[model samples]
Target: MPVSRTERLLNLLIALLNTRYGLGRGDLREKVYHDTSGNDVAFGRMFERDKNDLRRMGFEVETLTDTGWAEDDSTTTRYRIGKDSNRLPEVQFGPEEWTVLLLASQLWERAALGTAARSAVRKLQSSGSLAAVELPAGVQPRIKPAGQAFDDLVAAMHARHPVAFTYLAGSTGREELRTIEPWGLGSRFGQWYLMGYDRARQAPRHFRLSRFTSAVTTLDKDTYTPPPGFNIREELDTLPELPLRTAVVRVRKGRLLALRRRAADGKGVPPAPAEETDDGGYDTLGLPFRDPEVLAEEIASYGPDAVAVAPGELVAAVRRRLRAAAEFSASPKPRYEFPGAGAGARSTGKGTSEDQLQRMLQLVPFLVHNQGLRIEEVASHFGISRRQLESDLHILICSGLPGGYPDDLLDIQWEDGRVYISQDLDLTRPVRFTVEEASALLTGVETLRGLPGVAGGGALEAVALKLSAAAGEEGRRAAALSGPPVTPVTPAAADMHGTVRDAIAGGRQLRLTYLSPQRDSLTVRDVDPVRLYSQDDVWYFEAYCHLVQGTRNFRLDRVQELEPNGREVSATVPAAGGSPDRLFTPNNGDTTVTVQLTRQGRGLAEDYYAERVAELPDGGMVVDIRFGNTAWLPMFVAQHGGTARILAPDELGDAARHWIADALAKYDG
Candidate 1:
């Protein structure tokens, strides 16, 4: 079997560490680098390269020459890693510092930094430096999930290899093959983007990973290099701006409150009507958006709570989508295949070998610090199988400096199921965070700080200072350049946040006086806390609701008053059913309403109400949709600007007409 480069490096490191007296070139070639035993020059070059790599990783490789007895008159040379100088200095973290480090580690929960963070945490845990502090359940911040191409692209970026993939163009909706020299990857507004030099376009281009239509294939040839001083963040900031259009929309009371906050400036538009809904619940506001399609999707997601009021073209576009959805829903699965519909790119497991090398590098240092750890304990601590640990140990034992001899390999002991590293070659130190890793952690911490009640504390500041120090000058600069901008939190929201977090941490149920936007009413309920999380700057509490008799998500902004119930949480709260995206599902009590849509509204029927649509011979469609409450249905129909009409359920039409008449009454008045 052919040995891998990782195995070869492991063997060399072990050989160098085990020898008290260094072995000569011939011994290294024959014993350690046996594959190159016949080629003296190749072995010499490989040995030199290995030594340079180790030195670059902070190891000090030393060479010594000794003259044999006068009879022989021959000089023998040897090399070994300088143990004293290469050993990492002992450093301890205070409790607060440890907590901050843990927070930083948790920031990389799902990104490319995951492996490094996990290894770092394990080392810290094994050293007993972070034993006492527990990470809060609610503070595990996650960035938007990256596409399957993420790992491959990161590897290609590191290796300076060009990559080829089929991408769906956002502008034309056409699929095209693209080859690019990937410089860097970054996240903005919870989306991963690749900043690269497009070989075909012959210009720098940024592509969203979600736009990729095929698996990323790295070319075997390493062809391009990124320009010096190129910054991903700077490139993102310089991207061309989209033209904004002001849109008049009628919003249900308390719905889309965040958007209301964002649009407070009015942008020179006329003041919005103060007219409330028929039940005195809705508010009409003018908002600005750059992309009508994206805005349409967002507005549609609001169900009946929002309606497009003006910009006839925008209303038509939304109506067309809603009609398409309705038409598609009525069809019994037969019908047309939409363009650009295909299975998503499948994630590849090609990064395992690279991850293993990283794990070994970090594992050695941890083993050195915590000797006599059971194999199971070590394996569990590193989050790997025992078999994998044993395999790594096998590789380490056979590894050493270029001179391949019995005494040149690493000295590893796994006696009675406990692991011990007798000789570490002074490589027993966790690798420092790369600039990107440090920047990512810093960005996550910054986002956390912006969350309600998270900042304005000495602990967070101390954590930031320690992170900046550990990241070094390069990391500090990168973090400062790329981190997300902070958004200020309201005082009331901050206070409420502290109370909710405290309740969650203590396993206490909370009595909350919450305003229900859908019902347009204020109600009190007892909720057993599960976790508090944020999506798009809005915080929500996922809890077991005593009123609903099931899990529910309550927006923090809508929480009027919160008080601990003084009762311990007795029942186990089940994990949230789905992510925030699918937080709401139609229940048994929702009313189903059928509607008739004209041919122009077919798009809306197919796209928005597909699950309940039925196609008609006249190129029109009928859709049956379920609503928990009919309060916003009238505005939703009015948003279509009359392309769709209620066909069945006269009560729903009556409610919608009444709401629209009231809105028109206010506007005409």
Candidate 2:
């Protein structure tokens, strides 16, 4: 018999044991060799090899003594797992959970270890615990093939080989053949990216796997060396294509504030209102401010309020697109005829409208007060179809407000067709930011509130308010307060922060407008944004700057422009390992410190330190902190004066002493 036949016999034995609760030797032989009656002919060296294979594959087939299969009364010859050998835990499955499991298992089919997931399913089938569970036929999921390139790429990644391929740039439709030293694979925002070192550029880059045309793996493994001082996270944020020149156009009233907020905070903000300029023109916006075409639809939505404020070429592009849209909408819309309908509006069946409304009303009492309820149960209770229930829900979301929103009495959180409701909502309580929270909000908003493909000021403010209310009274109050006045020059520090955060989270590179005091010069550099931190009331981007050829800190206030670089970054760039200590360069010779922070500054320390607490004697906190760069400490001490002191790094102590002496000398003068 072939090896496949022998494997099937073992599977057959397990299945028979599960079905009969225990199988006799006669039954096992009959099932294993259906052609032979009462005959065990397949017992040879080949059979021993099959048994050994089964053992190697984690099965516990062994001799048992309880069945009385042996001639002697005291001995029995049977094969089964020993009672103590069942190390696998029993798991019970439900219909829905089982369906999900089956769907997830399909993902393994595309992987190199596809056989393992199938084996797992086979074992589950043999386990009597899952015997009663049946997944419905309608729940069968549609499986899409993962394409040849993705499979080949994944295999190459696992094999640790260099792959040369023609990669399609999704945005450009351009193909380039390049060799890459693969590092890792990650999925972000519904797209797959292959991280590796690009031999052509000799830098770390990430390529979208879906865009690769043809790829072949070479036998060479680990031949590539990542560029020295390269950081992958930093490289991700500084893609060249991602750094577009973004222009934010705020609306009337808090428009400038919103624009500043959007510029300062870089996560996407809600779309700006459609604006009409004095000349009946419109303003357009997008992230990285590089491509206006991507946000053409958004600009069109504003009707006319949107204005282009930067990069003359982008403004012209928006105008040209607007002209094209104007010409397109000028064409008449085509109409379709139904099978039996005349030109007039369709009529509802007799008495159907009242019945539908009554059914919807029945759902209101339960749905209005509850956060969530099952769609299936609700559909059954109301004698309604799923389609009808969904249509009613759409109407309900817009129904409650006295006029529109604030007075709206209800809201819904629809998840997988399940409805969650928030009732008796007060609209007048617009999302408010507290002084400190507003400070943080303004900090976040200034950078992010205006970009396309992101949430804007109005949306952010509402979300912030919702979060604040959920956080309780103190948070609400704290959010209500505003921060002290300090003017950051054009484009604002807040905008830089938002862009950097977006770039990091989006896995795109960043191009920053940096200003150095050496000369009043604006330098554009690509960087991977790794992390953001604030010290002494100032925000800075700790990114791997391609210009400096290393990781460096760039002050938010000094940044001129921050945009997403959509191009691939090298994945072979070594990650900035260790801790935040990596931020301090060797030439700087910065050190970590332990500090006693007064009650006020303790909160500040808590924000930065993972481990921070107040010690009793002085009502201050003992905090361990890393000052990657020491120059900022004196300014920090001066700003939050009386509440903070340097607790460690005796070198910092000497610096403080010198600073105090300088101050005393001024008094002597």
Candidate 3:
């Protein structure tokens, strides 16, 4: 059986740690890496690689040289890890601090951040310095960006490698091959962007990861050095501001409330001359937008609720796009080809490189202070496998100050499982946080501050203080300038969240009176709560429902009553699968409901049901959609008024008619 890299490294570490005297190359090959024992050169190379890996992970391998000490009177060299330098100091965290860290870890419970957070939590748990605390429910803020481009770009940026990808240009709507030296990665307005030096353009440019038409492939490492004093945050800050244009639009009364609130909150340009329509059902308002095309798309998405009154070009653009969509749906053959079909290639780089780099920077100082620790203890402290630890150490041993001199390099030693750093190039302290990192932390803390459990707590305040201190003057100023405020949780919902979270943690079942929005009725359920998550401001409890005999997501706000049952949850629940988009996906055995939508309802088909559109010759659209449950279909049709009507499934049409009639009866009453 072939031994895996991780297994071999683990075996090597175990052998070294168990032995009092470090084993020589011959002994190591025979005792640990027996697979390579036949080839002396291969064994030597593997041993060297393993030693470098250990050094990279901040392990100090001490070498003992003795001549005439052996029976053969030959100079023999023995290796051992210095137990003094490899251990991390025992650090105590206060309850508030622990809570803050816990909240921080929870905030990053999805993407790349989640991986680091898990490792950190593991390390903390293994140390037994801080007791584990239950995190608050409805406080998890996960950032899961689509595609592997972001991950690959981040790796290239860290490794100083050039990356090549096919990017769909926003200006031309054309796919073009781009080779760039990735300098930094950042997120703005929930979109990830890669800032890099475009090789073709010979200029710095920013590429939105979503626009990538192909997988990112990392080229040679150290392709080009970043210019001195190249600060990604500063570059982002210096980006030119987009010019805003005023747009006059008419919106339906009580509709577009979110937009009005955003404008009121000073998040966008103020609207002026907002006049009520004669029918008392519409309002005319002037809104400002940076991109007329983007604004047009937004207005189009609102269906008949919003319409562009002025700016003929914007109006024409929206109409043109809608007409094109309608025409495309009507065609049996392909009228237009999609731009990003080449995105099927696998991404070359891994996501964990950036996180590893950050950890390595912190590791230097940790090893410098602690000095001597056992290999296993060091690996556990860092929450890494022995192989990974060795790989990291290897990288560190070859890394040093800019001079590249022997004395300038890091002097790391590991012998007989113990490790130490004998000579350090003054790399004892961690590098200062970049602007993006500080901003991200501030954003995370601000988000956590709105959660019921974290709000009004000293933990957030303490965390904020530390973040501000680390951010320095510029970062502090950036953080001080607040973005949008977090949506506050309802008191009832907050209480339910606590109840469900506790039940899930304690392995107890829950009794809940849940208000079914679709059925417009209340139903009591016995649930074995599994996971608690939140999207935007809405909290959901993913539970194994005893009533349904399957997992279901219960909206916390819709839960009328929640009580923890004394019975322990005995049945094991399967893990939650699929993306966030899965919530909107129809079940396999769902009924296909067809609907004919008028031109005014074109936006609905264009935006929400893009995959279901079949165009009619008269500028209307027929949408064939699958619904897991048709309970909410009536209300959805009624909301669109006469613009949409069910064409198939007579039962659905009858239900929609009944819903409209019920509403009319209420008005009559």
Candidate 4:
């Protein structure tokens, strides 16, 4: 019978690792393959593939081509894996550094990098010298990778592959096809942007992830190599932020109060007298805008209640979005699936040999350091099933030196409920971190710098230096590939985080001087600290307020001042809800608004925890969202421009129309 692939690979690894002089193709075929490769051609192909696989797993398999210096030399080429290079160097870190490293590991959250970050951490933990450290309660920070698009883009970037997608242009409000050699991805101004070489444009361009009209399609790996020393962080520095400009908008008197307050002066006017329009009295305000698209969206959602009067671009954009939203409201709603309803189409999380090999390489060392662990516990740590772990243990028990003797193989036993690795065949150490592994970790840590009070002051830099030394050249390359460059929280904000962390840890009450934008007021209140976390790089704390007597979320930046109120928290605070994805908690009396999201606005479905009521044919979604108030629905529909419209609840739809109509009536001569 033909030999199993597991046995063949294990045998091949044994032959290569045990060889003093490099083994030639003939010797490898005879000793490792044992004629199971069918023929000479098959043997050669198998050997080449196996060599590449080992190299991909971070094993340095050296190839030496004979130079005909010896008269009796018959071997043309031979291969051998360097033992020292395959084994990881000793890694040591103090408690402070470990605290920061642990913090970095959690940054990826559920993003694709989370897996690599976790694996990298596991390898570090297997070093047998761990210092116990814990990050403070309620001080969790995470990177939000929106959906499948982020995973695909990050994968393509790592592989150096070119990607094709339909991108929606902001300036013209048009969709166009783009082929990009992705250099890096980062967030600026609360949005993710891809910096890449546009193949058609033949120049570098940045594309927003939300504007991608179609799913990203990866072309080929190694399509083009990025320039050496290309730093994603530095490249982002050259790009200018959206320039602020002013827009003249006419508002229905006393209506669109939010928009009016945005540009209001002391007298509630922009030095222009109020005039009566066909609908109601109108007041024109000089509204400052950084992006016409955003401004247009906000105006259009107001329907007839607000209108842009000046800056032809803003006026036209606002009109276009309002018209589209009005039209969509008149159309039939489509069907949509709930978030997890379509999960069957996703991957089953099966591990390939390539994946399994990497895990096992790390697993061996982890088991060496941590002996007598439960089989299930080991499987859980490695992120595999107990059945898969058993299969791996079986394969490992049969792997070792070329002789195939009992002592020649590894001695692994788990028949007694707990697993023990008595013999490891000199594979007791983890391998060096691969480029991809090191890159994900370094990028995560780099992002932590943007978080205030994370990495605990000096620990971040010291850990970074030590990780660079441990990761060596791979770490240097990782430095070139960067994630989003989030602006560091202000020094005051950092101090605020430190104070909030202490309060939450101590279960103390805090007196906060806060500015409430909704109320347009500055007030001081005593709030019992509960949890502190961040979503989208914005820090917020949930606390029970003495005035409101309910838990309310306070944005860190909005706080004018914060000090402990010198009292232990009275109320029994619930454990901080782990994830901060949804900052606003909905009330029972809130209305459930069904809305249709198309193109750019589709992200709102996830942002608001919308239930998939329907799906649209134009690659859009119809969802039902429970908003604390229907008052904000008009702004929501318009802010997404034409991409979102109120689908159900007739009165809410009428509100959108009336708001737009009043705004447009002001534009009439």
Candidate 5:
């Protein structure tokens, strides 16, 4: 039988790696490609593609053009895979550095970075340089989740590909198509920003993640490499802050409380009776803002309860948004990527041959270092099933040097139930960093520098330095990845993160000073922590609230104080009914409200977890959204300004109309 492509590639890798003088094209054709290719043109094409594939996999394939095979022709290039250049240079890490590195790797719990961080950590572990004890109590931290756009940008950047997206510019408040050569992505002040050379503008520009109106897409792979010695941070710093502007607003009493919290100096036009509202009273306040569009969205969410009193531009913005919202007719809506949608979806697929080959390359060195590990343990480490592991192992057993001999092929056996690699075929060390792997670790480590109360910060810096040196170009791609403040990394809420995580791990109860948005009040409560997770970049922890005597999800941002209450488990609440994936699920008590949503309001279906959604021909959506507390429905309707309308339960629509009438009344006066 003709040699399998995988075997041929392996033979090529072994031949190139073991060579000292660099193998010429003629030699590779004769030794590695003997059974695979006969035609000279075909062999040359295969050799070139394979060489490029090796480079993409992070191997340093050096070419010497001057040294040809026959003394007659000096132009034929000789290729050699330099072991020293491809492999990670030896490094010593104290336990503390390893702990910090572990924490850094844990930053991206979901999306692209999460996979990257995990794989990166495994590679580092294979190096035998990771000597880490479990992080001490009160030391664990978590990363805020990134959106789909963030994930796509990191992927495109690592692949050295250009990307295109529909971006809603903050300045113009207009959605436009933008194609860019992405350089770096990072957070400046609790918001994610992408720094890239805009192809349309032919200049470097920074775009925010929230402003992404559509999905990010990659253009062509290897479109153009970043300029040499480019730094992601240096590029990010060039983005200037948005100019500060303020808007004065009149708010009806007991309404628009969140807006009240952002008031300037707590002293404004003061309380006054209003003829425009059904409300008996109103408060006039001055609100400071940066972007008009953002402010308009916020004000519109209040419906007519809050109105712009001054600044003709601010008034115009609010009027325009409300008009657009009102004018938006219901059409079809795109689906949302809800958390944990499919059941047992992760275990079904066996990967392609190319994917398996890549994993085996990493698996060899890992097995070599971590000997006698259970088959299940190995499968878990590589994120595969036992059957797939067996398949890979059997294939590995058949792989070796070009020659077919007992000694030439690898010696691997699992019949005894404990895997042992008698021979690794010189694949005893992890292969060099794939761009994705290097970028993940680099981005995670950089995010560590921003985390508050993290010990061994210098160790993190040192780890980043080593990764950058080893990863080279891949490291720069990682530097381009950034995110908002993970939870409360500031001084005050720093320790609370570890405390919550520690409580969950140690099974201890917690005391919290949490601000509830619905109740519009702060309360001290004791609770048994269940789990911690994030969505849309916000952190939340499910805990059994003692004050309410029920399980509740608390927003980490609104948490003022959190500490262990010195109480043990009450055993009243089970962790789960088979440990479900989502933190919260819709209960029977939630009321279904039918709403007409325009294209701008489609996000609401996802936010509220619509029970059912039907697309409208006009690019709008009719969704049956669930809400436990319909009291906030009016505000929800108002926030979309007018893009959302209550189609059923006539009472909610009346409430929203009244709220808007009250706010619009301010401008009338």
Candidate 6:
């Protein structure tokens, strides 16, 4: 009753074809091979089956005539679902639509879609039914979950129980274990959050799901109760009125037309008709969101064309931040002086390199005007190849004007095998880094240079030099390390890393001097090192230890020496499960859980196990959480000491009771 690999492969192809605008036979082969991790023969077989499967599923595939596919005696197909050609829906957006949706989800509010919705949209777009459509008003409502925490929350919500999680609060470096009842999830401001009743604090709390870690579900029934106390509908229904600060502005009717055009183009909202005002036919600009300082600054930026008429408060606030900024700017001694200004002063113009400026210009032109440049064109222009161009571009695109989203200042658009630029030119001036900035950048570059299989150490050194030049004298001060910094490689670590990595990747067995808990011992062992990772400031190799015939984690630091046995691993290994970094490892103990009831908790318990009959009252319900092993139970029970109580599972109950007794015994006087 389980899906076979071949079936999964066929399904994956079908899914891709269904959603894409259309895939030619050759295109399908390429994509399948690439996405399947270079399984060419497997891809071909799956591709062949996909055609047959499509016909069986009632899709009308159009065969392209006089195409290479026809020469090979293969049908060149384009998927069409409709039975009647006249009634056929159009194929819409292609990768462009996918990219736009991705960006819109990040930028605009609420653009999350179900997997099914994504598939449908992809299919419609790929079929060539849709073309170059941007979301209306440049905004669409979509939901983007924060991460796996949200996925777990969804599973718990379906299970209908109070969920316990360690939540990181805001920017604070602290975590708290809180139990909450389930509620609907929503996305806002590019982050997913869960709003629910907090039982411990007895308040309505909202948590950003991204910061949630180590989530666990409680089996306790009737533990959560939603009070009629908070009326969500009433809260949402109240729309606050926007307070306005009035401002006066004179516009030549033509200039007024330009202002309207700019505003409409920026916001996709048409401005109202220009009307005559008391002072020589000036128009009134009533700005919303009463930050007078901001309004004044904005008006000032309009130069003499705009003037603030009333509500002097707005004007004053704008002057405050700006005046402060101006004062701060003027107070600083000049970094460089104009050549004629002073004999001893440093050069005043911020020295940005010609190459840096050209790079900045290239990014904007390629992303916006070119819709994205051809990889070949970029390579040719830079005197490099496509791969090198892409690598450099990715690094540049990632760096931006400091601080937050939309701050990225650059975007790439890919269309017709070319890239176009989206944002304005950045890095026009040479980048200057302070002592702190230069050292930080240098440290990053140094670490990256030490990474295995990474190339172009020269490029990293160049970036570091640019940063250093930007910092001038200040960068030198920041680079001065108080204590020796922990470098990534000290020649020793590099050699070890190289040897270990090569051995693992090559599937060769190793003989290592392993330090166990008891003592250091020389042992001969064979392992299929599945993954290499660093945990808690120590490097570890997770491998299939042949001695135990199971997975084990061996500390790299504890490794006294490693020698290759030159014997290749013969048996295959199963694909590892989820990234161990994000998932919990089974601890050497049992965990105990208890049930406590609030209206919401009870609702959750029922939801979790609706099919399993349970005893309940008219208003409350009961659920149970049991652990077969009692080792971890005591600690679990102690964390939620107030709400949870050990019941039934007598062994865990006894363990919890014994733990409490031991704690009290220690303090007994």
Pick by lDDT: which candidate is best?
4
Clash totals for all models, in order? Answer: 53, 79, 38, 17, 16, 76
lDDT against true structure, model 2: 0.44
Report every candidate's CA lDDT. 0.62, 0.44, 0.58, 0.72, 0.68, 0.41
TM-score winner, 1 or 2: 1
Compared to the true structure, candidate 1 yields what TM-score?
0.59
Name the lDDT value of residue 246 in candidate 4. Answer: 70
Error of 1 at 43 (Å): 9.6
lDDT of 3 at 506: 71
Ranking by lDDT: 4, 5, 1, 3, 2, 6
- Please provide, for model 5 over 443-491, each residue's C-alpha lDDT reduced to its tens digit, 9 standing for 90 to 100: 6666656554456547777877777787765665565565444545445
Alpha-carbon RMSD to native, per candidate: 12.1, 29.8, 14.5, 6.6, 7.0, 31.2
Assess every candidate by TM-score.
0.59, 0.28, 0.48, 0.72, 0.72, 0.26
Candidate 3, lDDT over the whole model: 0.58
Error of 4 at 249 (Å): 5.9
lDDT of 1 at 648: 50
Better of 5 and 6 by lDDT: 5
Q: Candidate 4: deviation at residue 630, Å?
A: 12
Writing each residue's lDDT as its tens digit, candidate 2 over 612-664 gives 33343433445556555675454344323234555557666455444433332
Cα lDDT, model 6, residue 471: 44
Candidate 6 lDDT tens digits, 1-669: 433333333333333424434545555544433343476667667656655544422234554444445434435554322223211133223433333333222221111122212222222222232344332211111222333355455445433467888875544535788888855344332234566778899887776554553444554565554443333223322323224333433443333343433333333223433446645444654333333433444443333244445554544433332333223222312222123332322211122232223333333433443344476875664344566456555544543322215643345545676765555433112122222223333333333333443334264455445434544543443322111112223466556656666776666777776655222244556776655544212356666778767667676655667878778755765433312211113333424333332222333332222212233233222334433345544433433222233443566566655654433222231
User: On residues 21-79, what C-alpha lDDT tens digit does candidate 4 reach at each position?
Assistant: 88887777776677754576776677778878878778888876767544234266777
- Model 1 segments more than 4 A misplaced: 1-6, 15-29, 36-92, 120-128, 134-138, 145-348, 397-418, 445-493, 513-524, 548-566, 571-669
